[model samples]
Target chain A: MRYEVDWSILARPELAALLIDGVRYTMIVAAVSTGVSLVLGTALAIARVSGSGWLRWPAELWVNLARHIPGVFWVLFFYFAFPELLPATWGSALNGWTSFALAAGIVALSVDNATYVSDIVRTGALAIPRGEWEAARCCGLSPWQQWTCCLIPVTLRTVTPPLANRTIHNFKNSSLCMVIAVPELTWATQQIESLTFRGIEATLVATLFYVTVALALGVWARRLERGGYRHWRGAGAVWRRERGELARVDSRR
Target chain B: MVELISVTKRFGERTVLADVSLAVQSGEVAIVCGPSGSGKSTLLRTLNRLETIDAGDIRIDGQSLYRSGLDLRELRAKVGLVFQQCHLFSHLSALANVTMPLVKVKRLGRGEARAQALALFRQFGLERRADAFPDELSGGERQRVAIVRSLALRPKVMLLDEPTSALDWCLRAEVVANVRALASRGIAQLIVTHDLDFACAAGDRFFLLQEGRLREVDNYTLACCAPEALRGLSSVPRGRLQAVAA
Candidate 1:
């Protein structure tokens, strides 16, 4: 038996709608997860650095545990096992909800992505000189103001390229949600294959979507490193120039 | 004015500052100099409460530093500290480095903070370098910017730790002039340094910290004989040094 490719099958109205819905859900999960994980990860990184053991230890434990586990396990666990842990009626209600899989997917993805971001951001924070902290404190800026006005901005700016790359990885990981029947882009491709036996065309389209978006994100990360943006958006560029100039002056002296 | 009333600090079983008493009048420039491990830096840090004392009291402008209900932010804002490395915020332009604290801590409007920062920049001859980042500036430029940043807070007392350590002779002279300018403005200064020339040129009074004890010495003694005398006293314990001085 030979496999015949028919690209026209995707033109069917119902099939097209399913693919459209799949793209929408895929983007929603990716975008929302990225936003949530960036915030949570930054906070977690700060917590791990805080002077109090209460904040630091718990944050350390969470990052360590989440980092070692696989992303698929988190997705499945949240979808299949989490509802069972809730109270009986609530568990049943959660299981009965139509969008439960989508919610679970977002939570699982966010949990997994945040650990990587936390590690990256913490590295940037530590790389800052001890002098910066002393300067801020000596100026009498409150601890909260110090973090917001100085530390967080510097750390996040320094780590933008790696953070952007992680976001791209998380966008691709949205495909993992299909295991729990979340019906994202990959699931739509499979559905099209199953119904009309035109899996090739659908798979090609889905692959193109992933490749195109991922490439765009990669270009953005590069531009951030190179200062391709008009605003003072490239902190890494500025940091490099600063180091280079200082080194040149030191040698002359 | 700044005062350290019998300020004492200990680390584990070792004493870093022992019964050290000193004062700087409103327009005075006091220099503290000593051999390495003699706690010159520790003595400076204690004034800003960067190092808490095991016992003793510190007062800036007649208000006790460690008093209950005293706001540390207020205390720090009143007594500015410039470090040996002049740790300017590398992420900000020199102008922003000064203005940020003004806007954030003093609640100055942005325009007001900019004007104040620019005025200091002009006074220090750093107006041309205001847009430069800390790393982009030379060592002298960076140190001046750091001092200007602290001054923008309008501190009553300024503490400088090894200001001339990283500078050439020309820059050292610039710092001496700067210290004199600060004193004329009535900002009392406590400078920690090993440069005897800088101390003699910039200080109104000189102090020596040896074996954790602070003692005032004349500028001539510090500049001429203090180095040889300090070397001779290195082996003497605190008690023996006190007995010998007596």
Candidate 2:
């Protein structure tokens, strides 16, 4: 069978706009989900290692559940079964909402990625010597101070490669959202194929989008690992500000 | 003053510290000698409440650590403990590593902390290495920074667990000099080490910990068993301030 590739479908303004919207939404979901997962996943990681069983058990259960289930199953479950679990008013409202699919995709992807992110965080935390934690404690740093300055930085530095891998995995996982009619890049490709019978051209554009973004993030993550990028501008005085605040309270003349 | 009255600690079925009682007075270098696993480390940790005692009480400057309403962070600030491995926060520079506790625990302004830290760094001759990270430093340098971190808080008592284990003999004299400087300032020192040579250098009130039991031991007896006494070894490099040590 001879394959005929048609590029005419993307030439029209409206069709082009649809693909652009798909790209935009896909990036938004990836970015927002990554941010949410980073914070929540790290918290879960700390809970998993906490001395109290009350904290550890719940975090462990979450990681285990997410790990055992496939990614597509989670997306579909969120899109289908999750709303029914909510209160009737919210459930029905969400079901009827125009952007419900995208919302569901973000929630599903964030948590699914969070489980893996937590594991990465846990391993990174464990990799640090216990002596470092003890050193901070003996110096009289509060639990919050220790986590922010010492623990978080070590975890971020040590697990940079794995974190980057996980993030790219998350971006790829956004494709799963298409199953719920979220109209992400992959869904847009399928729509263009159905309408114009030009599946190859649409699929090519979608693939390029995924590859470029994923590659760029991977590069950025590597740079982050090597200390090639500093996230906070004007963060130099942040610690000094903490000291200044302390001085005001304690009357350091 | 620091006092441990009938302090006992157990891990599962094993008693690591048993009814161990001791005191360290201001400006005194109280050394505890023990073989590996004799609970010397645990004794130091107990003073700072890093290792919870299964029985008895610890009093730092006349206040019972066991009593409620005690600000643990403030208490810890008054009693600084350094680990055997130096354990410098690897992510931070040497200067930041020392200043973090000052900012977080001591609540000192950056100006005050920086001034104090820089002064100590100069006193200890570590000013050149302030910006270096832990991995960038030698073992002696790392331990010195750890000491600086503890000193920045101006603790009433400083406890060190096997501090000299990480340093070469040449560095040991330097460390001993630093400890002497700290002692001169009237900060009580409780050092735990099995190295008789190192212990003797600071053993003003030398003691021994054996099988969880602790008792005062004499300096001459400890010097008899030093490695140099056995094999005539003097690892302390020549021209390494032997006169100052004398």
Candidate 3:
């Protein structure tokens, strides 16, 4: 059976607007979930390596439980099961909320993505040399200061590649929201295809967006690993100021 | 400025430091020489409370280290430690490595921290390499930067663990000179190393650690053990020892 390709259906103003809105929602879900997960995952990783049984065990359990469950399950659970589990009034309110599905997708993706991020960050934290900690301590930094100024920076730097990979995965996983009718890119594509019989074109556009974003994420990760963002202009200013100070000191000597 | 009072530390069934007592006065440089596993490193770590003692007490500038009210971070800052591997924050530039504690711990402004760190770099002849990362610096430069980072806090006492482990003979001499310069600035030093040449050249007092016990030793004993010490060997044959001594 030969089928004719018709790109004209997508030319309709309403259809184009729907697709644009879908992209916007998809980006919102992906960006918000990635940011929340990164911060939460870093905290979880710290708790896991904090050496206290109380903190470590709970974090371990959470990460393990999240990892064991499928991403789709989390999406459905947050959208369908989670509201049902709440109190009667709250459940009804949440179910009736217009943006409930969007909230569920963001929450579900963050929860799922955070576990993988925690594992990556934990490995990076553990891999840091003992000397780095001792160095921070010797300079009089408190435990919290050490992690913030020394340990965390180094660990995040080391885990950038893996963290980027997980972020890209989470971005792609936003498509899972279609199951709950969250109106993300994939859901919009499905809608457009059913209405206009242009599933191939819509799917192609969605796929291109995902591939482009993922590839861009890869580039960003590589740049970060190379320390490309460090500005030498600040260092140069410091250098010039110090040189003047040194000249004055040398004259005194 | 630093005192260890009969400090003892043990790991499982093994005793690393046993009743080790040592005192280092301000402006003095003390050397601790020992073979591998002789508790030298553990003894140094105990001063900074990197490794807690099972018994005994440590005092820095007349304040008890393990007392209930003592601030561990303040004590660590007051007692600077230089690691064998230099351990400069691999992600930070040499200047940032020195300025971090100044800005974060000492509460100095960013510009103030930069000036202070740069002054140390200039003093240590490392001003040119301030923007370089740890991996970009040479072995001696990294060690110097590590020393500078510790010195930036104006520590009362400095603990160096095998500072010469990665340096060649020329760099070892540079370290000896740097130690003397530091002493002149009234900062006491306690160094743990097997390099007799470095110890004899840099040390004002000498101690030996063996079998978990620490005792003051003279330069002659260190000279006598030079052959075995240089090799880091536990034992040297009598005939070879005599030949080397002769």
Candidate 4:
């Protein structure tokens, strides 16, 4: 197979515009969805651990349903099914909106990723020792304050590896937006392939982009783990030095 | 002052604490001792409403914990708890951990809270370790940091649940000594332990809990002389008593 690839497509002004637009749309969808998923997921996690039957049942059902359902189904549902369920005027406005693709992508990704985020946070929250809760209560922290201060920080640190992995997963899942004609990276590549008959090269370039970003995120996560470990080591050294000094002072006394 | 009145706790069919009643006056050090599974921990936990009671009520400074509409956060601020596991926040520096309650719960400014927390760390001889994380500290050091974090709020009562249980034999003495120093500062303390020596040394008064009920013992002399009296009332098996003694 003698493939004469036209590398000029990369430098074309029209292609450059599409690539820029694709990256912008992709980032906007991912960032908005990440924020929405984190807040909703954290709330779901708290409800699941609340030990109340009402809160637990609904939270579990939401997580299970979201996790089991295919991500593509959510994209289609938000883009199609949801509009029909709304009031006629509102439905038409949403359906006819220019930002419909962006809105649909955000909604689908938020719902799909929120389930995994909530599960990650819940595991971290539950792993905390019962004694920490006692200590928080003893300090007279309001339930809300305790949740925000003591519980959230520890849970976030403990679950960061998984949570960061999920964020990267959501980033890749943005490629799925091409199905709804959102014109992200995959969609841009397809456009190039159809116009220039250079599908393989375009796809290979896109794949490299995804791989590079994902690998960089993985490295950052590893650094965070090492930083936490180093912090623990520093504390131990200081403690020993203090004890030694105390002993010296006592001997002089 | 804290009081537990006819409190009972059950996990499904298993009864952890059964119809227990006790009173802790202001500035008193009450040490609770028993074999494992004797419900000593459950009693201490109930004082701050950490473990909810299935029956009866727990009153802290005249506020009923079991009653609806009580502010649990304000109530918790008045009562401080230290755990045997030294559950310090792994992500936070020691100073940040100590200052957390002061800033978040008490709404103190960061500088003000840090100053207070640093003073607490100094008091516990942990000033140098304030910038260190929990995992970096030794067992004894971690427990001291945990105590400082709990006491930073200036709680009226401190609950020490096996504070030295997680430490090695060598480390246990140092942690117990810090706890004894806290007692001398006139902080009301309730210590739950299986270590007879630690209980005798740290507790101003001892209480033997068996089968969810507590009987006060004036001192270690009485506890040792009438071991049978405690054993007779306790639901714990004889084998566990020998294990505890060993």
Candidate 5:
């Protein structure tokens, strides 16, 4: 079968509105889910390495289960299974609400994304030299202070590239909301496609938007990496210059 | 003052320290010399309770470190530890690393802590490198920064585990000089090293550790002067030293 071009449908004003709304919804879902996942994942990462069996076991189990389960299953579970388990009146209210889809999407994405975030953060924490921990202890920092003041900053810097990749993955995964009839980019594109029988046009534009945003984010991350490298290099050069001057002065003496 | 009473430590079936008892009086500088795997590092770590003793007790300034009714954080604040590999905080500037404990643990105001940190950095000849990160400094500079980071808390006692063992020959003197300066200020120090030269130059008192037991050598000058005795006390076996020098 041959595909037919539909340029008229692509030029419609209503189609643009749908695309704009879809983009806004996708951004919102990704932002909230990312925030939740970052906090939850950091706590889980700390627990896994805390050397306490009580904490490590639960954190490990949570990460493993979330990672093994499918994202779509989580969305369905929250949307369909969770309300049924609630008390009768609350369940009814939840099912009747217009915003239930958005909430379900947030929960689904947060759970799915947090496992990867925790894994990234755990690797960063492990990579820190053991000497750093001893130094913190010698300085009399409490366990909380050690984690908050010393560990997190170093871990975040080490893991930023991977963490940013996860954020992009989370953003793309927002497309999964289409299955639940959430008005995200994919769902809006499908709505436009069915109404006008111009699926190709809507699909192309949506794909373009996603690719552009992801590339823009990647470029920003590269800029950050370059800036960090330059700062460290300049500092290293200055140190070497000072050391050389001191060496020269000693030689003269 | 820190005292260890018949402390023993075991990992699995391997015994590291066996019924070893020692006392370090206030303002005393005691250097511990032993071979690799002789439990020298473990012994020093046990003083700070970093490694728990299997038996016996460690007391810091009349308070039992291994017993209840003592605040471990307070005890740790009073005792500083420096490792062979300097563990300056990678994320913070040298000044921030030095000042972190003052602000976070001691609750000093930011301005006051900065002033104190700047003074310590200057004292250690790190004033120019105060704003540098750990990765930005040389190996010698990083070790000096590590010493200043420990001294920021003004701990009464300092425990050093092979502080210069990881340094090159050129960098070793700078670290040893810093340790000597700390000792001159009347700060009690327990330095664990296998280097005969460092032990001779930096130690006021020397203890030879072998097979998990310690024998104090009271006359350090005589010990250093007599090459045979010094070689026997050193972790390096006689044949290996001859081979390396030859």
Candidate 6:
């Protein structure tokens, strides 16, 4: 009846393997989904702000649907309902696949994450005055060059924090894949809890895993938010490093 | 030469420009001066098609600018337009801002572009400020950076919208001098501002835009541009006329 916590269960080598595998899958899922979302989200942002209606409308529909619906619903939809919605041959092909759950999880997470990412990018991109675009154009940059070279770099300056936040959210959301029997960290924790009846230890490890990853991401995002990464040869740039080293050597001598 | 033939623009039901025709000859300094909301900026913007006309034909050197075959980026590069505010890329250093067009569009070597931009920055007296971001530079430095960036492409025509509005006396003189020097070197320029003194001083041909129409800026043109109520005072005595204007 007293409060006694046990950490001895995780001392086993098998338990260590299980936890490591869990961490591996969790990281893999987060990394894959984040890369896919960032690329897709940037395209969507460009479409939403584009002058053409063809590009704008479909992107608007996807963003509106993604933002309005809950992320969990998307996760569940991809896992449970998406293959059914596919044509029979494709659905059967998916059902026979070994990594169906992971693939579905990636699609679901990327789509859900992409919408918020697009929103962040669009807001940041739109915040730039129209004069900037005119200026770029006046300087003879093509539309493709304009967006890629100037607009996107500046947009990232404003969107980095929010983009990083959403990615971490997506990373945490990977735990939800456990609901579909994916062997992620949360799933491994549940298995240990049921098998060894020492859920406290497993739960603590899982909690620590998520906390450390999220903190690292937060710090990296802060670095990006400080900006000037795109600006060439800013104050204290690489060229000065040689001079600085020389000054140090002279003073030391 | 850059020519606007009956360039008309409207936003919703409000007509911003109506049958506005103007020309900027090579090496000419054409100034457009009018009160705010009189379409002075819009008129200058039309030279580079920054503001598209609902009905009009714009041509540069006898080539149709608004037509489908004309390349927009080329046309834009041909006629440079600098905004009233600095409009420098906040994320770019002054050197990078100047070099971007050279590297990206012109496909110049990075070293060459950097050299060109550094030279322009040096010429503009921004020697120590090349690596500075837009926020680090003062309003005048930013404006100079923007001008240098536009000039990197060697545009045949340059457009400046209220370049001196956000500047102090020293900065204004620098900007006006640079703009004048560009015109002297055979780049056609269209400058739009509300400052009559600047327009009179720099304009080879000054214009007064009123209620969507454009006209030459002369004494008769000024009297014609005045509202009907004010025109009645022109018949008054000289002192009374001055009082009325005041």
Candidate that would win on TM-score: 3
> What residue pairs are clashing in model 4?
A139-B77, A140-B76, A140-B77, A232-B136, A236-B136
> Can you write out model 4's per-residue Cα lDDT over B1-246, one digit (the tens) per residue?
778788889878888787777777776778887667888777877777777879988887777887889877777777888877877877567777777678888889866887787667767778767766777798888888888877888787888888766778666777667767767677778888777667766677888777666777777443455556455433334565565477
Better of 1 and 3 by DockQ: 3
The best candidate by DockQ is 3
Error of 3 at A253 (Å): 15
Candidate 1 vs candidate 5, DockQ winner: 5
Off by over 4 Å in 1: A1-5, A11-13, A83-99, A228-253, B229-246
* Candidate 4 chain B lDDT trough over 10 residues, lowest sum: B229-238
Report the C-alpha lDDT of model 2 over B25-90, residue by residue, as the tens digit: 999999987667777787888887778899999998899999989887888899989889988877
Q: Candidate 3, residues A36-127: lDDT per residue as tens digits?
A: 99989999999999979999999999999889999999999999999889999999999999999999999999999999999999999999
User: For residues B29-50, could you state the per-residue lDDT of candidate 6 as single tens digits?
Assistant: 9887666787878787777777
lDDT of 1 by residue, B1-246 (tens): 899999889999999899999999988999988888889888878877778999989888888888899888888899899998998876677777888899999999876887788778878988768767776899899999989989999999999999988899999999999999999999999999878778889999999888889999998777664444566333224554455456
Clashing pairs in 6: none
Q: TM-score for each prediction?
A: 0.87, 0.88, 0.92, 0.85, 0.88, 0.87
Give the per-residue lDDT digits (tens) of candidate 6, residues A1-253. Answer: 6646788778888887788889998998899999999999999999999999999999999899888988778778998898899999999999889999888888888888899889999999998888787777777788898898789877887778888889889999999788777788998999998888778889999999999999999988887677456323443352243234334434765
For this target, which candidate reaches the highest lDDT against the unseen true structure?
3
Candidate 6 retains true contacts at a fraction of: 0.67
Model 1 iRMSD vs. native: 5.5
Worst 10 residues of 2 chain B by lDDT: B227-236
Tell me how candidate 3 scores on lDDT.
0.87
lDDT of 1 by residue, A143-194 (tens): 9999887888778668988998899999999999999988899999999989
Correct interface contacts retained, every candidate: 0.55, 0.64, 0.71, 0.69, 0.60, 0.67
Model 2 spans > 4 angstroms off = A227-253, B225-246
DockQ of 2: 0.43
Native-to-model Cα distance after best TM-score fit, residue A111 in candidate 6, in Å: 1.3
Better of 4 and 6 by lDDT: 6
Q: Is candidate 5 or candidate 6 better by DockQ?
A: 5
Candidate 2 vs 3: which has more lDDT: 3
- Could you tell me the lDDT of residue A164 within candidate 5? 82
Q: What is the DockQ of candidate 5?
A: 0.45
